[model samples]
Target: MDDWRSQRIFRPVRWRSRYGRAESGKMHGCADLPGRMAMARKAKLGFGDQATTLVARGTRVTGDILFRGSLEVEGEIAGNVTGEAEAGAQVRVLKEGVICGEVRVPVVVISGRVRGDVYAGEQVHLTASAEVEGNVHYALLEVERGARVSGKLMPAAAGSGGDFADDAPTPGMPAAPK
Candidate 1:
Protein backbone atom coordinates (compact mmCIF):
# COMPACT_ATOMS: atom_id res chain seq x y z
CA MET A 1 0.00 0.00 0.00
CA ASP A 2 1.18 3.52 -0.79
CA ASP A 3 1.64 5.37 2.48
CA TRP A 4 0.57 8.95 1.80
CA ARG A 5 2.51 10.28 4.82
CA SER A 6 5.77 8.49 3.97
CA GLN A 7 6.07 10.28 0.62
CA ARG A 8 8.42 13.25 0.52
CA ILE A 9 6.55 16.51 1.01
CA PHE A 10 8.46 18.18 -1.84
CA ARG A 11 7.76 15.33 -4.30
CA PRO A 12 4.85 15.58 -6.73
CA VAL A 13 1.88 13.36 -5.76
CA ARG A 14 -1.48 12.64 -7.26
CA TRP A 15 -4.02 13.75 -4.63
CA ARG A 16 -7.71 13.88 -5.53
CA SER A 17 -7.57 13.37 -9.28
CA ARG A 18 -5.46 11.13 -11.48
CA TYR A 19 -3.40 14.11 -12.60
CA GLY A 20 -0.17 14.75 -10.78
CA ARG A 21 0.36 17.70 -8.47
CA ALA A 22 3.41 19.04 -6.68
CA GLU A 23 3.12 18.29 -2.94
CA SER A 24 2.97 21.36 -0.75
CA GLY A 25 4.41 21.87 2.72
CA LYS A 26 1.03 20.91 4.33
CA MET A 27 -1.23 17.93 3.77
CA HIS A 28 -4.39 18.47 1.77
CA GLY A 29 -7.92 17.86 3.07
CA CYS A 30 -7.31 14.12 2.77
CA ALA A 31 -8.14 13.86 6.48
CA ASP A 32 -11.75 13.07 5.49
CA LEU A 33 -10.69 9.97 3.54
CA PRO A 34 -11.49 7.63 6.43
CA GLY A 35 -14.85 9.27 6.98
CA ARG A 36 -15.64 9.01 3.28
CA MET A 37 -14.91 5.30 3.37
CA ALA A 38 -17.17 4.94 6.37
CA MET A 39 -19.91 6.80 4.59
CA ALA A 40 -19.64 4.53 1.57
CA ARG A 41 -19.85 1.43 3.75
CA LYS A 42 -23.14 2.62 5.24
CA ALA A 43 -24.87 3.56 2.02
CA LYS A 44 -27.13 0.45 1.87
CA LEU A 45 -27.85 -2.69 -0.12
CA GLY A 46 -28.51 -2.12 -3.80
CA PHE A 47 -31.30 -3.43 -6.02
CA GLY A 48 -29.23 -6.35 -7.30
CA ASP A 49 -28.77 -7.84 -3.86
CA GLN A 50 -32.43 -7.20 -3.12
CA ALA A 51 -33.65 -8.71 -6.37
CA THR A 52 -35.79 -11.85 -6.20
CA THR A 53 -34.19 -15.27 -6.60
CA LEU A 54 -35.59 -17.86 -9.00
CA VAL A 55 -36.25 -21.58 -8.87
CA ALA A 56 -36.21 -22.52 -12.49
CA ARG A 57 -38.22 -25.16 -14.32
CA GLY A 58 -37.65 -28.91 -13.82
CA THR A 59 -36.04 -28.36 -10.45
CA ARG A 60 -37.39 -29.62 -7.14
CA VAL A 61 -36.79 -28.98 -3.46
CA THR A 62 -38.18 -31.15 -0.68
CA GLY A 63 -37.61 -29.32 2.57
CA ASP A 64 -38.85 -26.37 4.55
CA ILE A 65 -37.45 -23.02 3.51
CA LEU A 66 -37.04 -19.83 5.48
CA PHE A 67 -35.86 -17.50 2.80
CA ARG A 68 -34.85 -13.93 3.55
CA GLY A 69 -34.90 -12.94 -0.10
CA SER A 70 -37.55 -12.92 -2.80
CA LEU A 71 -38.05 -16.11 -4.84
CA GLU A 72 -39.56 -17.08 -8.13
CA VAL A 73 -40.65 -20.70 -8.23
CA GLU A 74 -40.84 -22.40 -11.60
CA GLY A 75 -40.15 -25.92 -10.38
CA GLU A 76 -41.52 -28.06 -7.57
CA ILE A 77 -41.24 -27.44 -3.86
CA ALA A 78 -42.76 -29.79 -1.30
CA GLY A 79 -42.36 -28.03 1.99
CA ASN A 80 -43.30 -25.06 4.06
CA VAL A 81 -42.03 -21.65 2.94
CA THR A 82 -41.77 -18.79 5.36
CA GLY A 83 -40.42 -16.19 3.03
CA GLU A 84 -38.68 -12.96 3.91
CA ALA A 85 -40.87 -10.37 5.50
CA GLU A 86 -39.91 -7.52 3.21
CA ALA A 87 -41.71 -5.30 0.79
CA GLY A 88 -41.86 -6.75 -2.73
CA ALA A 89 -41.05 -10.21 -1.53
CA GLN A 90 -42.80 -12.63 -3.90
CA VAL A 91 -43.12 -16.26 -4.97
CA ARG A 92 -44.16 -16.78 -8.56
CA VAL A 93 -45.11 -20.33 -9.45
CA LEU A 94 -44.90 -21.06 -13.12
CA LYS A 95 -47.18 -23.44 -15.01
CA GLU A 96 -44.78 -26.33 -14.52
CA GLY A 97 -44.22 -25.77 -10.83
CA VAL A 98 -45.96 -27.43 -7.93
CA ILE A 99 -45.76 -26.44 -4.28
CA CYS A 100 -47.21 -28.73 -1.62
CA GLY A 101 -47.06 -26.89 1.67
CA GLU A 102 -47.71 -23.69 3.52
CA VAL A 103 -46.42 -20.42 2.07
CA ARG A 104 -46.41 -17.17 4.01
CA VAL A 105 -45.12 -14.30 1.97
CA PRO A 106 -45.88 -10.73 0.97
CA VAL A 107 -46.90 -11.47 -2.62
CA VAL A 108 -47.76 -14.72 -4.39
CA VAL A 109 -48.32 -15.06 -8.12
CA ILE A 110 -49.34 -18.58 -9.00
CA SER A 111 -49.80 -20.06 -12.45
CA GLY A 112 -49.35 -23.66 -11.44
CA ARG A 113 -50.46 -25.94 -8.60
CA VAL A 114 -50.31 -25.45 -4.85
CA ARG A 115 -51.60 -28.13 -2.47
CA GLY A 116 -51.22 -26.26 0.79
CA ASP A 117 -52.15 -23.22 2.76
CA VAL A 118 -51.20 -19.76 1.54
CA TYR A 119 -51.09 -16.49 3.42
CA ALA A 120 -50.13 -13.56 1.29
CA GLY A 121 -49.75 -10.39 3.26
CA GLU A 122 -50.16 -8.15 0.26
CA GLN A 123 -51.57 -9.85 -2.81
CA VAL A 124 -52.16 -13.18 -4.52
CA HIS A 125 -52.59 -13.63 -8.25
CA LEU A 126 -53.73 -16.99 -9.61
CA THR A 127 -53.56 -17.30 -13.35
CA ALA A 128 -55.40 -19.74 -15.59
CA SER A 129 -54.40 -23.39 -15.12
CA ALA A 130 -53.51 -22.70 -11.50
CA GLU A 131 -54.97 -25.38 -9.26
CA VAL A 132 -54.97 -24.71 -5.52
CA GLU A 133 -56.51 -27.09 -2.97
CA GLY A 134 -55.92 -25.49 0.37
CA ASN A 135 -56.60 -22.38 2.41
CA VAL A 136 -55.85 -18.90 1.13
CA HIS A 137 -55.81 -15.71 3.16
CA TYR A 138 -54.74 -12.54 1.46
CA ALA A 139 -55.35 -8.81 1.56
CA LEU A 140 -55.70 -8.71 -2.23
CA LEU A 141 -56.43 -11.53 -4.67
CA GLU A 142 -56.94 -12.08 -8.39
CA VAL A 143 -57.73 -15.31 -10.18
CA GLU A 144 -57.84 -15.67 -13.91
CA ARG A 145 -60.31 -17.65 -16.01
CA GLY A 146 -60.20 -21.48 -15.70
CA ALA A 147 -58.27 -21.33 -12.48
CA ARG A 148 -59.28 -24.04 -9.99
CA VAL A 149 -59.34 -23.24 -6.31
CA SER A 150 -60.70 -26.08 -4.15
CA GLY A 151 -60.20 -24.73 -0.67
CA LYS A 152 -61.40 -22.29 1.93
CA LEU A 153 -61.00 -18.53 2.21
CA MET A 154 -60.67 -17.07 5.66
CA PRO A 155 -59.85 -13.67 7.05
CA ALA A 156 -56.38 -13.15 8.39
CA ALA A 157 -55.87 -13.10 12.12
CA ALA A 158 -55.08 -9.81 13.81
CA GLY A 159 -51.60 -9.04 15.13
CA SER A 160 -49.04 -10.28 12.58
CA GLY A 161 -49.29 -7.86 9.69
CA GLY A 162 -46.44 -8.68 7.31
CA ASP A 163 -47.24 -12.36 6.66
CA PHE A 164 -47.41 -15.35 9.03
CA ALA A 165 -51.06 -14.63 9.77
CA ASP A 166 -52.75 -17.96 9.24
CA ASP A 167 -56.20 -17.37 7.77
CA ALA A 168 -57.90 -20.61 6.92
CA PRO A 169 -60.46 -20.52 4.16
CA THR A 170 -64.04 -21.42 4.95
CA PRO A 171 -64.70 -24.41 2.64
CA GLY A 172 -63.95 -25.56 -0.87
CA MET A 173 -67.58 -26.32 -1.72
CA PRO A 174 -68.64 -22.66 -1.63
CA ALA A 175 -67.03 -19.90 -3.60
CA ALA A 176 -64.56 -17.87 -1.60
CA PRO A 177 -65.47 -14.26 -0.87
CA LYS A 178 -64.08 -11.87 -3.35
Candidate 2:
Protein backbone atom coordinates (compact mmCIF):
# COMPACT_ATOMS: atom_id res chain seq x y z
CA MET A 1 0.00 0.00 0.00
CA ASP A 2 2.98 2.31 0.37
CA ASP A 3 3.78 2.19 -3.36
CA TRP A 4 2.97 5.28 -5.44
CA ARG A 5 1.54 3.17 -8.29
CA SER A 6 -1.28 1.95 -6.07
CA GLN A 7 -2.61 5.47 -5.43
CA ARG A 8 -5.75 6.49 -7.24
CA ILE A 9 -5.06 10.25 -7.16
CA PHE A 10 -3.03 12.02 -9.75
CA ARG A 11 0.56 12.93 -8.87
CA PRO A 12 2.06 16.03 -10.46
CA VAL A 13 4.49 15.03 -13.17
CA ARG A 14 6.96 17.19 -15.08
CA TRP A 15 8.85 16.04 -18.15
CA ARG A 16 11.72 17.76 -19.96
CA SER A 17 11.65 17.98 -23.72
CA ARG A 18 14.71 18.44 -25.97
CA TYR A 19 15.17 21.93 -24.51
CA GLY A 20 16.20 22.60 -20.91
CA ARG A 21 12.78 23.63 -19.66
CA ALA A 22 10.00 21.25 -18.69
CA GLU A 23 7.44 20.59 -21.45
CA SER A 24 4.89 17.98 -22.53
CA GLY A 25 6.53 14.82 -23.75
CA LYS A 26 7.45 11.29 -22.84
CA MET A 27 9.33 10.87 -19.59
CA HIS A 28 12.53 8.88 -20.06
CA GLY A 29 11.18 5.69 -21.73
CA CYS A 30 7.80 5.80 -19.99
CA ALA A 31 4.40 7.15 -21.06
CA ASP A 32 3.59 10.83 -21.53
CA LEU A 33 2.78 12.97 -18.53
CA PRO A 34 -0.62 14.50 -17.97
CA GLY A 35 -1.14 17.67 -19.97
CA ARG A 36 -1.46 21.04 -18.28
CA MET A 37 -4.63 21.91 -20.19
CA ALA A 38 -6.40 18.65 -19.28
CA MET A 39 -9.29 20.49 -17.65
CA ALA A 40 -9.76 23.08 -20.40
CA ARG A 41 -12.54 21.13 -22.13
CA LYS A 42 -14.82 21.14 -19.06
CA ALA A 43 -18.03 23.20 -18.81
CA LYS A 44 -18.41 26.31 -16.69
CA LEU A 45 -21.38 28.64 -16.30
CA GLY A 46 -19.41 30.88 -13.89
CA PHE A 47 -21.22 30.20 -10.63
CA GLY A 48 -17.90 29.42 -8.87
CA ASP A 49 -17.70 27.74 -5.42
CA GLN A 50 -19.97 29.84 -3.23
CA ALA A 51 -21.08 26.50 -1.81
CA THR A 52 -20.88 23.00 -3.23
CA THR A 53 -22.67 19.67 -3.14
CA LEU A 54 -21.74 16.39 -4.71
CA VAL A 55 -23.63 13.43 -6.12
CA ALA A 56 -20.75 11.03 -6.45
CA ARG A 57 -20.11 8.36 -9.04
CA GLY A 58 -21.74 4.92 -8.47
CA THR A 59 -24.38 6.58 -6.30
CA ARG A 60 -28.04 7.04 -7.22
CA VAL A 61 -30.76 9.31 -5.86
CA THR A 62 -34.37 8.31 -6.26
CA GLY A 63 -36.21 11.54 -5.42
CA ASP A 64 -36.21 15.18 -6.42
CA ILE A 65 -33.56 17.52 -5.11
CA LEU A 66 -33.89 21.17 -4.06
CA PHE A 67 -30.61 22.85 -3.38
CA ARG A 68 -28.89 26.17 -2.72
CA GLY A 69 -25.40 27.05 -4.01
CA SER A 70 -23.80 24.54 -6.36
CA LEU A 71 -24.72 20.91 -7.05
CA GLU A 72 -22.17 18.81 -8.84
CA VAL A 73 -23.36 15.47 -10.23
CA GLU A 74 -21.01 12.69 -11.19
CA GLY A 75 -23.56 9.92 -10.84
CA GLU A 76 -27.19 9.16 -11.79
CA ILE A 77 -30.17 11.14 -10.58
CA ALA A 78 -33.58 9.64 -11.13
CA GLY A 79 -35.54 12.81 -10.34
CA ASN A 80 -35.72 16.51 -10.89
CA VAL A 81 -33.24 19.02 -9.49
CA THR A 82 -33.93 22.63 -8.65
CA GLY A 83 -31.86 25.36 -7.10
CA GLU A 84 -33.04 27.68 -4.38
CA ALA A 85 -34.31 31.22 -4.89
CA GLU A 86 -31.06 32.88 -3.95
CA ALA A 87 -28.71 34.18 -6.60
CA GLY A 88 -25.59 32.22 -7.71
CA ALA A 89 -27.29 28.85 -7.51
CA GLN A 90 -25.95 26.40 -10.10
CA VAL A 91 -25.71 22.79 -11.27
CA ARG A 92 -22.87 20.99 -13.04
CA VAL A 93 -23.08 17.55 -14.59
CA LEU A 94 -19.73 15.96 -15.27
CA LYS A 95 -18.82 13.73 -18.18
CA GLU A 96 -19.90 10.49 -16.51
CA GLY A 97 -23.04 11.89 -14.88
CA VAL A 98 -26.66 11.38 -15.87
CA ILE A 99 -29.81 13.22 -14.82
CA CYS A 100 -33.12 11.64 -15.72
CA GLY A 101 -35.41 14.56 -14.82
CA GLU A 102 -35.79 18.31 -15.04
CA VAL A 103 -33.14 20.79 -13.98
CA ARG A 104 -34.09 24.29 -12.85
CA VAL A 105 -31.35 26.68 -11.88
CA PRO A 106 -29.85 30.09 -12.49
CA VAL A 107 -26.75 28.59 -14.10
CA VAL A 108 -26.07 25.20 -15.68
CA VAL A 109 -22.87 23.57 -16.93
CA ILE A 110 -23.47 20.16 -18.45
CA SER A 111 -20.83 17.82 -19.85
CA GLY A 112 -22.82 14.64 -19.41
CA ARG A 113 -26.31 13.26 -20.17
CA VAL A 114 -29.57 14.98 -19.24
CA ARG A 115 -32.79 13.16 -20.11
CA GLY A 116 -35.19 15.99 -19.28
CA ASP A 117 -35.77 19.69 -19.69
CA VAL A 118 -33.41 22.35 -18.41
CA TYR A 119 -34.32 25.86 -17.34
CA ALA A 120 -31.48 28.26 -16.81
CA GLY A 121 -32.47 31.70 -15.64
CA GLU A 122 -28.94 33.02 -16.15
CA GLN A 123 -26.97 30.80 -18.52
CA VAL A 124 -26.56 27.31 -19.96
CA HIS A 125 -23.18 25.99 -21.04
CA LEU A 126 -22.84 22.66 -22.82
CA THR A 127 -19.47 21.11 -23.47
CA ALA A 128 -18.45 18.79 -26.27
CA SER A 129 -19.36 15.77 -24.16
CA ALA A 130 -22.86 16.98 -23.24
CA GLU A 131 -25.88 15.07 -24.53
CA VAL A 132 -29.32 16.47 -23.72
CA GLU A 133 -32.48 14.65 -24.80
CA GLY A 134 -34.94 17.37 -23.75
CA ASN A 135 -35.67 21.04 -24.22
CA VAL A 136 -33.36 23.76 -22.99
CA HIS A 137 -34.74 27.09 -21.80
CA TYR A 138 -32.08 29.65 -21.17
CA ALA A 139 -31.40 33.35 -21.10
CA LEU A 140 -27.95 32.73 -22.59
CA LEU A 141 -26.50 29.51 -24.02
CA GLU A 142 -23.04 28.36 -24.97
CA VAL A 143 -22.58 25.08 -26.82
CA GLU A 144 -19.37 23.47 -27.94
CA ARG A 145 -19.00 21.76 -31.29
CA GLY A 146 -19.94 18.22 -30.30
CA ALA A 147 -22.69 19.07 -27.80
CA ARG A 148 -26.11 17.57 -28.64
CA VAL A 149 -29.62 18.71 -27.75
CA SER A 150 -32.40 16.51 -29.13
CA GLY A 151 -35.30 18.77 -28.15
CA LYS A 152 -36.02 22.46 -28.67
CA LEU A 153 -33.63 25.22 -27.76
CA MET A 154 -35.85 27.82 -26.22
CA PRO A 155 -34.44 31.18 -25.31
CA ALA A 156 -36.46 33.54 -23.18
CA ALA A 157 -35.91 37.03 -21.87
CA ALA A 158 -34.35 37.29 -18.43
CA GLY A 159 -37.62 37.97 -16.60
CA SER A 160 -40.37 36.74 -18.94
CA GLY A 161 -41.19 33.48 -17.15
CA GLY A 162 -38.89 31.12 -19.00
CA ASP A 163 -39.66 27.98 -17.01
CA PHE A 164 -42.93 27.18 -18.71
CA ALA A 165 -44.05 23.62 -17.92
CA ASP A 166 -46.44 23.32 -20.85
CA ASP A 167 -43.71 23.31 -23.48
CA ALA A 168 -43.41 19.57 -23.71
CA PRO A 169 -43.93 18.16 -27.18
CA THR A 170 -47.09 16.24 -27.95
CA PRO A 171 -46.62 12.66 -29.08
CA GLY A 172 -46.08 12.12 -32.80
CA MET A 173 -46.39 15.85 -33.49
CA PRO A 174 -44.13 18.42 -35.04
CA ALA A 175 -41.84 20.42 -32.80
CA ALA A 176 -42.69 23.98 -31.79
CA PRO A 177 -41.13 26.89 -33.62
CA LYS A 178 -38.00 28.40 -32.15
Per residue, candidate 1 scores C-alpha lDDT tens digits across 85-173 of 65556788889888999888888888989998888888889899889999888877898899888887654555656344433454676
lDDT of each: 0.75, 0.83
Relative to the true structure, candidate 2 reaches a TM of 0.63
Q: For each candidate, what TM-score against the reference?
A: 0.62, 0.63
- Could you give candidate 2's per-residue lDDT for residues 18-87 as a string of tens digits? 7688743333423442333333322243333466889999999999999888899999999999997464
The number of clashing residue pairs in each candidate reads 4, 0
The per-residue C-alpha lDDT of model 2 at residue 139 equals: 84
Runs with alpha carbons beyond 4 Å of true place in candidate 2 = 1-49, 158-178
RMSD of each: 8.5, 14.6
Clashing pairs in 1: 152-169, 153-169, 153-170, 154-169
Q: Indicate which candidate wins on lDDT.
A: 2
